[model samples]
Target: MARRKRRKTRVVITGISGRLGQLLTRRLHRLEDHEIIGIDRRFFRRRPKDVEHLRIDIRRKACEDLFRTKKIDVIYHLGLMHDPRRGSQEHHTWNILGTQRVFDYARRHGVPKVVLLSSTDVYGPQDDNPAFISEDAPLLGAQRFSQIRDLISVDMMAQSYFWKAPEIETVVLRPVHILGGVDNAMSNYLRLQRPPVIFGFDPMMQVIHEEDMVSAIHAAATPGLRGIYNVTGPDALPLRRLVGLAGKKPLEMPHVLAPTIARQAWMMRLLDAPAAELEYLRFAVTVDGSRAKQLLRLNPQYSAADSARAALRLGAWDAPSDAANQAEDSKGATAA
Candidate 1:
């Protein structure tokens, strides 16, 4: 009898309902002869018919058992809490313990590769540094308790997994300010009022388009790749200029006074103004992507201005119909 060829393996992704995970699932499903499994707590609005959806919390031990039983080939870990109020205990339970359980299952099931998604906020606040900071730069410990716990979870998982299972290829992607058609914490502020609130004169912001972020993760899992890479877009823009580009005027607000203003806004029920979230607005963090560019061969298609224009044109601020139509025409002209 002739020898039979082995079947092509399947790839599993956690946090499938997230913006990045949804994009990735869609992209991978377009490829021929590859199986994609998505695991998320909530059911996604529009998942491909062929893609298998598993509604499960990764923090639970049973999820690990399910993975071990299925014997998935590659796993992408993209689940984590960003809310500052969640505190260290919650962060450890969800991010660290959850990751460890998944990692253990992958090891037992002989999973080939794992890609862990981390945040560029791990670099901490850069007050006035103009140049981009690379992956080689030391990780500034998270200032807030929530961030500290999240970063620690990622670090411990990455380091321990690498040490224990040298054979399993593990890669970490730290993305900065992921934007594009998503109601993320950062972009929510952009949607607030006409001429978004700006903190100080020089709050430099760098953003990574959601598409490019997914591409980087895809590249990481494509056989023979390991190590950490910082993923960001081409340029960093000042908050004021970014707001202006979004077709909104910029209202300069002093960082010191923002707390008081935010408190009042919260009292008035104008904005969800938690103190921790307010602190995040007051600082700036930027990341360099030279290594990602060179290694992943990724050239992010969207610039900061492009993203701002797109978000504005998408009517994120709920502009009047006439104003939105005019902005759309202007965006078209600029693109041309």
Candidate 2:
């Protein structure tokens, strides 16, 4: 009898032009059995030769043509927008409708697995939150922060796929503040020369290194794993300690005046995030990652300090000099 050859897994990753998408693409491309297909409206700089990059909106009819033609084994949904400055209607349409289209394509194409990169911020920072929130907790992240409602809607849509399409293994990962060379709000804040802080408030925070988050996504995309999981780093630390780890000083502001100042900054286009994001600075929204550890067999390799250092473009996994990275981060903030 002749030996049989295995087929390559065809993987589709949306938002493939973002920093995290670039990281995931490199990791997956290294695997000989994986064929990478990137879908995004932005340019994929330094794109890998073997990988296919499609610069198109996920909401467009053309996005469905990819599913119609190829045998896509898995879909990594990382296309959810998070910029607070974008209009609410635009955000909702892009996130909710675009995500619905992805799920519809998966169902129609018979894709066996779908992995969504949701954020722990969907849980919303609150004073009454448990010490460690589990997967079953209510998503109140948008209760006060209306801007994130689209994210919450997308998460709920993915969750609905669990029961609606049982054949497709839907895995939603709500990772805590993701810190690295990425241009997210948390990373950008840490890169600030003197990051602002709520006076007399130092909430406990959890963060995952960008690489660890990609690892968790890979684990979730495995053959048998399904359902929602809260992915977290190895440890948690206070907000001030995280800021200190990033080699920055905290400029404390009284809680009463912080929102007003944030609004002014927003009006003057000085702040990347709106005043509503300040809620995260005052309360905790830590999650329990025991499910991911036991089920997905995920063991985070980065410490809180290591993650914080990565945000500043320092340490072993450094990308570029702080000056260069800060400039790029500012230029690329809303691009993703």
Candidate 3:
């Protein structure tokens, strides 16, 4: 008698309705032997034909039912909250506690693989920061910015799980400035008609196109790929140049007073992220992706600058004319 063929791998992904989540779900759903199971509090325009989407929070006890029913082999933890307001209880509950709950059950259920999505902002922007930061760098992103404290804590949790459970394959991906046609904090900031920039500071930054981010997730799901990986686009661009490339004017301002001004804008709901995120414009937190390229074989198809340009166009910001933008930039004025 012939040997039986192996069963397909059933993979669960949280935040399935999110733009990035949907992208990854669609890609993995098309795979020949991969089953897609999604967990989200909401749904998008449409889901894949065979995907099983459950509208439940990750922390809910009902999650175990999915594992028991599907015998899930791997899970993609991509659910993250991006509210910039300080002391958001929901951010902590969803981003941190939710992760705790997911890992807790996965280990209990004997799930063997987990892939986590983290942001490069964990390194924090500092003048002393090396031009090319690696995984070994200290994650001080939560120092002044308490908003991202949950991200750092969750990152630590993932790292802890990697060591504590030697049998499991835990892969953590920290990508810089994830952007595409989607509108997120970084993307929305970049799409502004005249985004603010720290005076006399032009920090270098990297951005990974959303497509590449999804590709990295796909690679992380492979059998043997497990570890911390830095995924980024091709090149780094200066703050002013980046905005110009996006057909937007740069509003120069003092880094000292920027926080207060930004907070006001945030309260008025003019800007998506709080003042803490503006540190990216003051210092470079550029990451080196050579390890991910060699280990996960992530071939980022889109360049950072090109992604920024395309994202700007897609966001449909009513950017002022080139002459007007130049005039405003020359005055070093402020934007409301």
Candidate 4:
């Protein structure tokens, strides 16, 4: 009789309801040799047909129950609240404590690897530094809503897990200004009428396409790699240029005036919009991805302009009923 073949290893991902999680799940589902499992509190609208999805809050103790049944080989922890949400405290519970729960589960279950999605926001404001800030650069003082919490969580996870479980490799991917066809806060800002609001001189903006983000996660899971790595697009451009690429113009505003203006415009009520958004406007935040490219062999295909256009064409932002007329008037006023 022929020998029995071993079943392929299964990989689980958190935050299946989120934009990045949805896209990553669809991509990973297409791989024939792996089984994909997605976990989230809410249901996904467009779940891949081949993937298995479990609805459970990672913050709850019940999350450990699922691990007993599935032999998970890898865990991709990508769940977290972006800015503008009123859930910073909840985000910490879910992002930090939830991560700890998953890490504990993986270690106990003998999972070989885990990838934690982090942000370049940890590298705080870059005022005088060079354009491409490498991973070696220090994580400076915080200015944004997500920066402080992300830094604290990543640092704690790195220290606690890396030394304890050497066999269960843990990797962190720090990405900056993630842009793609996903509906997000930054993409919403791009959809506003031209003469788009600018807090000060348009600072240099660096972005990463969502597909490249998935690629970096895949690279992290590949054996023999463990540590933190910065993932970003190859180029950095002025924020105004990026706005123009989305067919919008920049409207200069003083940093001191943004809070009042944003509040008056009633834009602060939007998801992830708050006074914290204005802090990033005063300085440039860039990242050096040479290490990701050299080590992970990741080649990002999309440019900042490409990401801008894709975001617009995909209708990632909601437009008001009179948006066309307002856009036309803004264009006429600018041309005149």
lDDT of 3 by residue, 147-170 (tens): 888899999999998778877799
Go through the candidates in order and give each one's C-alpha lDDT. Answer: 0.71, 0.88, 0.81, 0.72
Candidate number achieving the greatest TM-score relative to the actual structure: 2
Q: lDDT: which is higher, 3 or 4?
A: 3
Per residue, candidate 4 scores C-alpha lDDT tens digits across 4-72 of 867876888998778778766765665667788888888778666878877878867777777887788
Poorly placed runs, candidate 1 (over 4 Å): 1-6, 84-89, 128-130, 144-148, 194-200, 263-269, 277-283, 310-336
The TM-score of candidate 1 is 0.82
Number of the candidate with higher lDDT, 1 or 2: 2
Per the 3 Å backbone cut-off, how many clashing residue pairs does candidate 2 have? 1
Query: Worst 10-residue stretch by lDDT in candidate 2?
Result: 314-323
Rank by lDDT, descending?
Answer: 2, 3, 4, 1
Per-residue CA lDDT of candidate 1, range 55-80, in tens? 98887666766676776778998876
Q: In order, how many clashes per candidate?
A: 0, 1, 0, 3
Off by over 4 Å in 2: 1-4, 314-336
Q: Which lDDT tens digits does candidate 2 get at residues 1-336?
A: 498778899999999988888888877876778899999999998798999988999989998899999999999999888877788899899999989999999999999999999999999989999989999999999888888888998999999999999999999999989988788889888988889999999999999988889888888889988999999886788999999998899999999999999999989998888898999999999899999999988776667777888898722234436534643564475356
